[model samples]
Target: MAKDHGPTVKDDKLYEDLLRDGASKGKAARIANAKAAGTLDHRSSELEDRSKADLLKEAREIGVAGRSKMDKAALVKAIRMG
Candidate 1:
C-alpha cells in the first residue's frame, strides 16, 4: 500500500509511481493531484491553438519563471513542458 505523503498530495500511489518513473518532485505532485482531480491531460498538440494569455496562465499555475517576456511559442513550450 502507498503511504500518505500528506494532505497536499491527493494521490499517493500515483505520486510514488511517478517518482519511481523519475519524475521531478513538483512534476509528480502536479500530475498526482491532477489525476486525483480528473484534470490530467495529454494534449500537447492542442497547446498550439491556445492563446498566449492562456498559456501564460497555465505557466503561472505551474510556477514557471520568465513567463512575462516569453513569446506565444515560448509560452506554449513552457506550459507543455510543465
Candidate 2:
C-alpha cells in the first residue's frame, strides 16, 4: 500500500505509482494534484505539431536548460524528459 503523503499530496496512490515509475517528486506531485483537480484530461498540443517558436516558449516556461540553442526536435525530447 502507498504511504499517505499528507494533505498536501492530493493523490497519494498516484504519487507513489509515479515515483515507482521513475518520476521526480515534483513531477509526480504536479501530476497527482492535476489528476485530483480533474484537469489531467485536458491535453496540451503535441510536440510534433508545434512550431519551433512554440516549443521554445514552452521550454522557456518549463526552464529547460540551453533552450535558446535547442532545435525543435531537441526541445521536444528535452520537454518530454523534463
Candidate 3:
C-alpha cells in the first residue's frame, strides 16, 4: 500500500490575532507570510512585494487613519510599523 502525504502548514490563530489587532498593509503581509508557511490562503503575497504607492493604496483600502494626508513613504512606514 502507498503511504499518504500531507501538505506542510503553520499556525492559523497567530495570523488571525494579528489581523484582529489592526487592518493595514502590514496585516496583509502577515497573512502572506502565513500563506507562505501554508497556513492562511495565498492571496496577499503579491501585496508584500508591492511599491510604496501601491502599498499605500492597499493600506487606504484597509482603512488606516490619516492615510489620505500621508505621503507614500509615510504610508509604507505606518503600514509596516503597525
Q: By the lDDT metric, which is better: model 1 or model 3? A: 1
- The stretch of ten residues in a row with the least summed lDDT in candidate 2 is 39-48
Highest TM-score model number: 1
Cα deviation in Å at residue 28, candidate 2? 0.6
Model 1 segments more than 4 A misplaced: 45-54, 72-82
- Tens digits of per-residue lDDT, candidate 2, 1-82, equal 7799998889999999999999888778877987899876333568888789878876776679999998889999997776
Q: Tell me the tens digit of each residue's lDDT in model 1 across 4-82.
A: 9999999999999989988887888998999899987655548888777778877888999999999999988776566
TM-scores of all candidate predictions against the true structure: 0.66, 0.63, 0.40
lDDT of 2 at 53: 83
Measured with C-alpha atoms, the lDDT of residue 32 in candidate 3 is 43
Q: Which candidate is the best by lDDT?
A: 1
The whole-model C-alpha lDDT of candidate 1 against the native structure comes to 0.86
Residue 4 local lDDT, model 1 = 95
- As for model 2, its CA RMSD to the true structure in angstroms is 3.2
Task: For candidate 2, give the lDDT.
Answer: 0.82
